[model samples]
Target chain A: MDFGAMVDYLPLFEQAMWLTLRIGWIGILGSLVIGLVVAMITHYKIPVLYQISLFYIELYRNTPLLIQLFFMYFALPRVLGVGIDAEACGMLGLALLGGAYMAESFRSGLEAVEPIQTESALSLGMTKAQVMRYVVLPQAVSLSVQSFVANIIFLLKETSVFSAISLMDLMFVAKDLIGLYYNTTECLVLLVIFYLIIILPVSILGTVVERKLRYGAFGS
Target chain B: MELLGLDVLFKGSNAMRLLQGLGVAVEISIISVVISLVLGMLFGIFMTWKNPVARVISRIYLEIVRIMPQLVLLFIVFFGATRALGLNVSAELSSIIVFSFWGVGEMGDLVRGSLESIPVHQYESAAALGMTKGQIYYHVVIPQAVRRLIPMSINLVTRMIKTTSLILMIGVVEVMKVGQQIIEANRMVSPNAVFGIYGTILLLYFLVCWPISMLARHLEKKWSN
Candidate 1:
C-alpha cells in the first residue's frame, strides 16, 4: 500500500483538502442564494421570471455537471473575452449546477408550506415580503430540512468534478501524488478517508435534523 | 451565421462524432443499468432482511456509496483497484463495476423504501389467507412494491444515464469526451466550437433525460390514480 509514500504526501493532501472545502463552501453558499431566489420566483408565479426560472432548473438539472463545467471553463471565456482562473471557474460551475437541484428542492419545500399561512399573515396586516420572510421561509426551511441537507451532501461530493479543471482540489492532489509515487491504492484510501471525515458528520447531522423536524418540539 | 456561437454544431463531421459518442454513452448506460438492476434488487431485499449481518453489510454499502463522490469512486477503481489487484481492467469495465455497486446502493434504498411503504395489513392479510411466506411475497408483497418501485426505478435509470458522463473523466470515450475532442480539433478553424459542440451535447442529454422524467411523472400519476 506504500504507506510511507502516503505519509510523505500528507501535507499536499491537506492543502488540497482545504481547497476542496473552500470551493465546496463557496458553491454551497452561492447555490443557496440562487436556489432561494429562483424558488421564490416560482413560488410567486411572476410571469416572465417564473418561466425563466423553470427553464433554468430543467436545463441545469437535465445535463451533466462535467458538460456544464466544460462550457463555463472553455466557452464562456471565449465568448466573454475575459480570462477566469481555474478556481473561479470551478466554483462558478459548481454554483450554477448545484443551484438547479437546490432550486427544485427549495421549490418543493416552499410548496409544502400551506397557502393559508401566507393568507393569515397577510390578513394580519403583514406585507407580502414580510409574510414570506417570516411565516413562509422559516416553516419552509424546517419542512425541507432533509432535502436541504441532502443537497449539501450532493454539493460536497460534486466538488470533485472541479479536479477536471485542475483546481488543486483533493482529487487533483491525489492524482498528482499517485503519478509521482505510483502508490495508487494508498493514495486512494487516503482520498476516501479525507472525504469521509468531511461527509460523515454532515450525513449524521442530516439524520439528526430529519428526526428533530419530524418529531421534535417544533412539531411540523 | 454564428447565432450565439451555436452554428458549428451542424457543421461537417462534428455531428457524426457526437452521435458516435452518444452511442457509447447509451451502450455503457444500458449495460450498467441491467447489471445494477439485478444486483440492486438483491441488495434491496437483503437490506430489508431481518438478519443482523445482512443488515450491517447493506448499511455499510449504502453509507460508502452515499458519502463518496462518483468521480472519486471511478478513480479508485480505475486507478487504485487495478494497480492494487494487478489486473488490467478496461475503463468501460471499471465504470460498469462502479455504477453497478452505486446502483445497488441507490436502487436497494428505493426498493427498501417502497417495501416499507407498503402497509402492514397487506402482509397480515396474506398470512391470514394461509399463504406461506414465499407465496405472500410472490403474490402480495412484490406486486404492491412493484407499483411503487417502477417510477423511482425509471428515475434511477435516467440518473444512471446522466451520470455516465462521469465515465469520460476516466478516459472512456463517451459523449462529453467526444465533444471535447471535437472542440480541440476545431479550435483553430471554428472559434465557437466549444459552444457549438457542448451545446449540442447538452441538447442531446436534455432530449434523453427530459422524456424519461416526464414518463416517470406520468407513471406516478397513473399508478397513484
Candidate 2:
C-alpha cells in the first residue's frame, strides 16, 4: 500500500489540513452571521426582505453544494468580470450554502423561544431590536446550538467538495497523493481517517454542549 | 440582446440533454431511495432491538455514514469497491450502491427516532393483550411509527435527490454532468452561455426539489400537530 509514501506525504497533508480548517472556520462564521440575519429578517416578516430571505434559503438549501461551489468558482467570476482565488471561492460557496441551513436552524430556534419573553421585554419598554438582541437571541442560540454545531460539521464535510474547484484542501491533497503514488488504498484510508479525526472530536463536543445547555450551563 | 445566453436553451440539443439528465437523476434518486428505505428499516430495527452485536454494527454504520462525505463514499464505492471486490461495475450502479449506503444510515436513524418516540405504554398494553413480539410490532408500534417516519423519510428523499448531483463527480452522466457538458461546449461561442446553462440547471433543481421540500414541510406540520 506504499505506507512509506503516505508517511512522506503527511507534511503536505498537514498543510492542506490547515487550509481546509481555515476555509471551514471562515465558512462557519460567515454562515452564522448570514443565518442569524436571514432568520431574524424572516422571523419579523419584513415586507420584501422576508420573501427575499425565504427565496434565498429555499434556493440554496434545495441545490447541491457542489454546483453552488461551481457557480462561485466558475460563473461568478465571468459574470462579475473579476478573478477570485480558489480559496475565497470555496469559502464563499460553503458560507452561502451553510447560511441557508443555518437560517433554518436559527429560525427554528427563534420560534422555540417563548413569546411571553418578548412581550415582557416590550412591556419593560425595550425596543424590539433590543429585546431580540439581548433577551431572545441568547436563548434561541443556546437552544439551537446542537443543530448549529451539526450544520458546522456538515459544512466542514462540504469543504471536501472544494477540491473539485482545485482548492488545496485535504481532500484535494489526498487525491493528488493518490495520483502521485499510485497507492489508492492507503491514500483513501488516510483521507477517511483524517476526516474522522477532525469530525469525531467536534461531534463529541457538540454532545457535551447540548448536555450542558440542557442543564442550564448558559443560563436558562 | 442575448438575454444573457437564454438563447442557448432554445439552441441545438441543449434542452434535450438537460431533460435526459433530469430523467437519469430522478431514476437514480428513486431507485436508491427505495433500496435505502427497505434496508434502512431493517437496520433501524436492529438498532433498537436488544442484541449487542447488531446494535454495535448498526451504530458503526450510522456513524460512518453520518461523518463521511458522500463524494468520498462515492469514490470508495466506485473506485475502491470495484478493485477490492474484483468486480466490474458501471458508474450508475456504483452511485446507487453508495447513495443507498448513505440512505440506510440516514433513514435508519430516522426510523430509530420514530421507534423510540413511541410511548412505553403502547408496548406494555400490547403485551398485556396477549400479543406476540411480531404481532405487537405489526399491530401496535409500526402503525404509530409510520406517522413520524413518513415525513422524515420524505425529507430524506428530497435530500437524496439534491445529493445525487455528486454522482457526476464519479463520471455518472446525471443532470449536473450534463450541465457541465453544455457549458463547456458553449463557453467560447457565447460568453453568456455559461451563466445561462448553469442557471437552467439551478432552476431545474429548484423546480424539482422545492416542491418535494414544501410537501415534506407540509407533512411535518400536519403530522406534528
lDDT (CA) per prediction:
0.85, 0.85
| Tens-digit lDDT track of model 1 for A1-220 | 6678878888988898889888888988999899998998888899999999989988888887877887788777777788789888878888888788888888877877778888889999999899988888888877778888988998898888887777888888888878887878888989998999778899999998888776312533
Query: On a 0 to 100 scale, what is the lDDT of residue B143 in model 2?
Result: 85
User: Which structure among the candidates has the greatest TM-score?
Assistant: 2
Candidate 1, DockQ score (0 to 1): 0.70
Off by over 4 Å in 2: A124-126, A215-220, B1-3, B125-139
Candidate 2: residue A162 lDDT (0-100) = 79
Model 2, residue B124: distance off in Å is 3.3
Instruction: State the weakest 10-residue window (summed lDDT) of model 2 chain B.
Output: B1-10
What's the TM for model 1? 0.93
Query: What DockQ, between 0 and 1, does each candidate earn?
Result: 0.70, 0.65
What's the TM-score of every candidate structure?
0.93, 0.94
Model 1 off-target regions past 4 Å?
Answer: A119-125, A215-220, B2-12, B125-140
TM-score of candidate 2 relative to the true fold: 0.94
